[model samples]
Target: MGAETNGNLEFLSKIPEIKFTKLFINGEFVDSVSGKTFETIDPRTGEVIAGVAEGDKEDVDLAVKAARHAFDHGPWPRLPGTARRKILLKFADLIDEHAEELAALESIDAGKLFGWGKAVEIPGTAENVRYYAGAADKIHGETLKMSSAHQGYTLREPIGVVGHIIPWNFPSTMFLLKVSPALAAGCTMVVKPAEQTPLNALYFAHLAKLAGIPDGVLNVITGYGTTAGAAISSHMDIDKISFTGSTEVGRLILQAAATSNLKAVTLELGGKSPLIIFDDADVDQAAELALLGNLFNKGEICVAASRVFVQEGIYDQLVKKLAEKAKTWTVGDPFDPKVDKEQYDKVLSYIEHGKREGATLLTGGKPCGAKGYFIEPTVFTDVKDNMMIAKDEIFGPVMSLMKFKTVEEAIQRANATRYGLAAGVLTKDINVANTVSRSIRAGTIWINTYFAFDKDAPFGGYKMSGFGRDLGAQGLEQYLQVKSVVTPIYNSPWL
Candidate 1:
């Protein structure tokens, strides 16, 4: 529901409509080289929210040139660690100050609930900035033990100009994830956000300027992947490319990068994660978590537990209870304060596909309404591990519940898919938890709780889900290069 513009809430609700035309380049707003622009439509209302700059190869070259210049000869990379940290801290504070406006833009543009955008995504972005800001001052080199008559050490230095391409599902958060660490590591970057959700990113560039970030240190370009994205990936000036999107696109980026400088790449791609529920687990709690795991963010998340592997002993009971609970989840306008219409029609379409694909939908295989993208939260029972619904990464609010006889079968079925982003297990037995957790090949595993995260935890995947982490110290290391410094104490006799 849109907030009221009266009484105590007037100031909070009086967000002015933003009209963005030009992209942010070299610390200023400028149009594309071709003078091209595209309309960013709101998924909820199917209305053109704003016309964004349509950047192509030439624009990408300009942005990358600026960023490369900044990284090679500008003060951004040469700044002391404390100075960089101070600037990042100020950026985070500015984000906090404009939290409401950013959240509103994200909610309207991305079809996410305003409450979630305000309460979780915006604050999380600020925390990520602050986290990396603090980490900026702590990056250091190590002294090595030398066997020869030479002083040996190592340097962890910035990888130079980086190209960051973010996804649409979590625009603000992913922007911070890719940009914060790169900036903190002293690598100037040119960011290409998903065309579906480009507004928040442009707004972020505005905030960076407000925080006193230097020109060419951070830039935002808006355009399709074929043109703008290809140029950024294939640019010789870029030293590294950090992308968060589908696996298919990541492969293209890798190929393009290879064609040029073979830049270091960090990709956080797709997943068809699993949630296993054992016989001894709390059935009610497990069912609730199952629903939440698949329904959170309208199941638009990359690590959403699309497949649920339940033990045979309690499979039927859990399925029935989960179906009843799924019915209670309201689907309506995302702006509606009382409803959770986040995924709506997009989710419903997946539900229809499940039925048409002969997945034997046990419950919730229909649309909740004719208006909005509202799909009934659906679950399938007679699902096999090899089914399309189970194997594919359906980015919607649908879960395929399958049964397994033992832990070995569960693990076999869970790891059968190429994805290994995240998995959840529900069991009271510590040994069982430990065994199952170690056996499942996901990047992150939960014992009883599902969809949990920490800023310090390393998150990524094995297999086709893609690699490289997004948070923690390990995440920061992805943007850095390790250089070994060697100097001889005395001239070699051979020389």
Candidate 2:
């Protein structure tokens, strides 16, 4: 197949050649125990970029051993909080130094927008590292005054080896989200990057070593989720598992952890989040936020506002502006080539589902170029609550618009879905914002903007979206085990 590079991709010449492509273990890059390898394709060009090691059960066991050793006896966990913080700061600086390479790797490996990869994902990842570095020494425990007979306190200790099963959509961001906090919490981890996008994780392993993290502190395994992921979830030696993926896979991981060591687990799963635009809001601003809410990252986001509710008073004007904005989007070649065929087909299928379910096609409904995986940015109007496109989590650039009469109706319709990951409300009325935000059952509620993520904000979902927060102080708790300590002020009679 012939691949078309977007606008000649002059920047591609600046990307350094990729070198490392193997399972990272014990501060070294090595092949799988079975001596097997698999091809990692560039989603943009749909061509083989490199042959990555195919890690299996044997590889997972070895990684777990490395992590277990690090947690139990290695220098990383034993290091002073200040020392750990210094090393993590160095790691973040190194990432900043190599931001271009990491961004290029992510763009090539995952079909992320080139500008977004270079300007947003890479810098944001480093920010996460730096933010958590500041928290390394701040993992505080409580000093309590109990009954006078005893002095009682608590300790927040590391939970030992952790398994991080990363997702493909936001590879670098997701990696940092799990790894940074775990590192800050003094936990060693075995990371299984998604097979579809393993390049950046391996690159990061090299950076971690350069930043002076000890051997076995971080191990990355690349392979099919069934073999390597299963081993990690069920590994008896691993103390906890942090996963970001679909609800189906999250359930399987929960079961595996339950049946094996009953290890601690935190999941960031699927979502069908909603965005509500009231009549009182600025129509133009609402249209812009609505577009960003649904189409950012090609709508592959877990918290994407795929279900949009516009107040009936301004529904027609908002839909018109949204459609016009959708048409203006440059819909080809995310990095240099287009999106991968798999995702392209998936988005197209959802567009077709919208048509079949009686949703009016607003502006776009077709693929872009003939050469690469490019789908036109799509919008739909007159969507009903029960439509498949309205309810299902279509992780693509397709927006479903529906009309609502009142704020109560919007809140009720938004909360009707099984998911509760995130929601956005656009309104000038402070009461409307407060009331609707309070009523909507979502982990995060955006008052006027959309997709505003910060290191200090805790992010997660209720209902089927998943449990456990991923950022902020709550995120660090995921890798920590709380223990109460009690000591007598004087010698007891029994003693």
Candidate 3:
């Protein structure tokens, strides 16, 4: 460990101080009620970055109480939409102003690349905040056309206290994705940032206060999922919950919500997405896209194209192109942003399983560096439909490449797995694109491209991948409740 992290030394110089480690409740940074703490490890050096407050059931309860009070009796809900919008705009401005610090913190905490965090993640988070802030004043309900002789309308009101359980990958992005819409909808929330990467969320809480958000409106509790997350899911005061993580955890949240006050739940769960490259597609471009789809975010993406199906004619050519394009992907941050040790071991284990299951390793099946949890970009060829690597959501930089003779076969194999989160179809023919994209059983399908996410476009998963959306006007729908109001006219039939 002594000399293995020399690459990180220069980058470490720019890392921001690890401040705001305590639980953020009622607009104040405070320790957990139980006074316990957990270590947040830096993935690059395998070193403890800082000790953060470990929120348990008691902490979650306090967060819930504060959020409930804010929603029920505070000014956030009663304030005009424009007023809320103004505050949120200021919040976005603050995020933009501190983009560098936030990016550095993400790098130190989550092993995320500083450049990408600075250029894309940080600014993109601010953009989403602004997007939702603009929509704060535009939430509208339709004037109902009643069948009877009466006047009727619908009011879209904020759903009470909400619980947002964000995943570690892309913490800031997911933060804005869930919190911004709820904030715009005038709903108070208790947030449980993933324990592995909780620093950014805590920093976000600090920024929220600086932007003049009312006390108790947005509270963040950093702790393990079994305790804090489970408490949030089952808390009676929390009217709704939005979670992004594994399907296994998602089911637990659903059960907790059902067993409690029957809180609304929105889950954006895991995926074993497929990228289909047809014979008619551009070989080089498709290969590059396949690399991008598999390795983007170090292959930690929930929507990663871990399964790649290539047509029979161009399979060999595209495979070579894919390996060639993979060369450019090697350049990035010093340590790839793996969440923690478990993930690193898990990725290595998946690679081992891929080899044992008869899938041929095309390239990169081992660890990258001596120290840090870095798995090399791995690709396996001749992957069968039934193999674990092909079916399971490995959540790593491992790709399973297979060959299909026809479009029907490709589509069949793409939708073979239990996941229906996302998929990519690469084809020059419009008819093929239309047919394949429509046939795949996924919530979002990209044609000739991958990861085309936007703030205006709603995103979610299908089947076991979970329900509800996280962006666009629909993203805010989960945070709001619709109530119908009707009044009979003087000449109504009832009168």
Give the top-scoring candidate (lDDT).
3
User: Poorest 10 consecutive residues of model 2 by lDDT?
Assistant: 1-10
lDDT of each: 0.85, 0.88, 0.90
Those runs of model 1 whose alpha carbons end farther than 4 Å from true positions after fitting are 1-15, 337-350, 368-370, 491-495
| Winner by TM-score between candidate 3 and candidate 1 | 3
Error of 1 at 352 (Å): 3.8
Candidate 2 lDDT tens digits, 1-495: 124454465656745588789999988999999999998887666778899999999999999899899989998877888999999999999998998888888877887777777787898899999888888898778998985678889998999999999998899999999999999989999999998898999999999999999999999999989999999999999999999999999999999999998999998899998999899999989888888887788788999988889999999999889878787778766554324577778788888888998999998889766565667778899999999999888888888999999888998899999889999999999999999999999899999999999889999999998999999989988988899999887775544
Off by over 4 Å in 2: 1-9, 335-339, 491-495
Clashes of 1: 7
Candidate maximizing TM-score? 3
RMSD of candidates 1 onward, in order: 3.1, 2.5, 2.2
Instruction: Write one digit per residue (lDDT tens) for candidate 1, span 361-429.
Output: 877767655544546677888887777788888787789988899989988888888888999999999
Superior by lDDT: candidate 1 or candidate 2: 2
lDDT of 1 at 11: 34
Q: Where does candidate 1 clash, by residue pair? A: 1-335, 1-336, 1-337, 344-373, 344-374, 345-373, 345-374
